[model samples]
Target: MTYYVAREGSKLWKRVLGETKVELQLLGEKWKLLLVGVILQYIHGLAARGVHYLHRPGPILQDVGFILLPELGKERAYISETVFSFMFFSFVLWTFHPFIYQSKRFYTVLLWRRVLAFLVASQFLRIITFYSTQLPGPNYHCREGSKLARLPRPDNILEVLLLNFPRGVIYGCGDLIFSSHMIFTLVFVLTYQKYGSRRFIKQVAWLIAIIQSLLIIASRKHYTVDVVVAWYTVNLIVFFVDKKLPEMPDRSTGTSPPLLPISAKDKDSKSKEEQLKLLNGNSLDTSDRRPRTQVNGKHLEDSNPVNGDATMNGT
Candidate 1:
């Protein structure tokens, strides 16, 4: 039940050596599902990139949010990225922060599992919505004279997939029906709200999420609708996901059961049965042997006095 803290050295090494084996086993048990979640993320990225090739010159819609808010232009749009990076790393740190406390209930692995579920689901939906209709991207990269706005056709499908593997997402255009940024931002905040306890910190996280959303719009990184759609869609997806998935076991009191394979659990039950059988066998062996007594200088088995009395009365 001992939790490891931030300090690194022999103490941490020993702690990990003692505890991480079961945690790793627990994670390994669901590696296949986790791998699927990972693959879905990659596919989501590929879909987003593939759809980027379909960007075309089109009319920008009259967005009320955009109309009211001033654009920061391309030069200053990076501010949003800065704020987002802060929030992103803050969440990452917070996920690991519980390791330092005695009352830590959640583990980092479970947190990522939930994160993957929410992200993959939302990204899948985003892929469908974005590709359904090519909205003219509102980002600076989608503007005239921008290389990304008019990318040359790829020689083959492999080229499309391979070319986008590492850097294409940065320069890609037209995957903007719903803001991927907001999806991540909102998902992180909502997750923290559920798993974390600090009310003040949660309020600050929500504030940061809101600022990040507004920044995405004001910076022209995404249309107002994209951010707006992301707000509700991500929330709903997380809600449904939480409802569908089994609840994570709480480890705060160290009384929560550890995840075990069916075989292991079966073995435990079998051992208990064997122990019970042994107990029953010992009881039967003891019951079969009656006490012997010397009576009237002769050995005789002890008889129930009540049975002897009843027999005399009947005679």
Candidate 2:
């Protein structure tokens, strides 16, 4: 029995592995591969920027503009950072969690496909935003001796610091063109639409993302118009991609229909079978048949008779 059980377990493992391999193969020609390369490039560019400026001198004047509006920079960073983190971690969990915990094979497939979709959407948006339009350089200056000065005041250190951190970090991170946060939030909300129980949580997450984006705009880390453009760009990309590549079918239920209350037709069919069984019980088994006999002044037949007595008979 132990050997049989071990053999069964091995077969199940092989089958699951086969399914995973097939799913991966199916994605080889899809947009997911291109998205993966895009993500790699994004990360590499961040690393390169960090190395390029690691030992540079203190922050420049335009850097000061970003530093003062930390809230703004933070809002921008929050959207991208949060979404990217969610997708990356989700994918990690899907791949490693199942192996460690023996989770349902189909659930793993669903998660993998979801992550792939997000990655594709994200990269596609990034490409669009990068090439959309260029912002003018920070060379414009205030008119000489004008009452309104362009540079931040010395006392605005707190504001500068706030803006500085997000801008410096984000610029350093190489994700300045597009909003990762918006893309991820939209994707997650759409993908998990079946989870009606978590609607509040989803709403809150969206609110947080939007609030962060607003802060980025208000603080001047990004122009209000730039944020608007980013938002629209993300939405447009998502819309087009969704139309072209509808989400992969969920595989967790083994192609079964969703669970629902039993139908009247099903119940009626079961009831008919039960009633027929009751009506035909006697004919169901030959062994249950009895030899011919009668009682209470009725004629009867017996296979054998004892002492010529009709009552004491055996068959």
The TM-scores of all predictions, comma-separated, are 0.78, 0.42
TM-score (C-alpha) between model 2 and the true structure: 0.42
Q: Write candidate 1's Cα lDDT for 257-302 as tens digits.
A: 8566568888999888878978654333446577654444544468
lDDT per model, in order? 0.81, 0.48
**Winning model by TM-score:** 1
**Prediction 1 TM-score vs. true:** 0.78
Once superposed on the true structure, which residue ranges of model 1 sit more than 4 Å away at CA?
A: 1-10, 98-101, 163-165, 261-315
Report the C-alpha lDDT of model 2 over 208-298, residue by residue, as the tens digit.
5576565554444344444565666656665665667545444444675432356699999988887787775434455755565444444
Error of 1 at 36 (Å): 0.7
Q: Where does candidate 1 have its weakest 10-residue lDDT segment?
A: 1-10
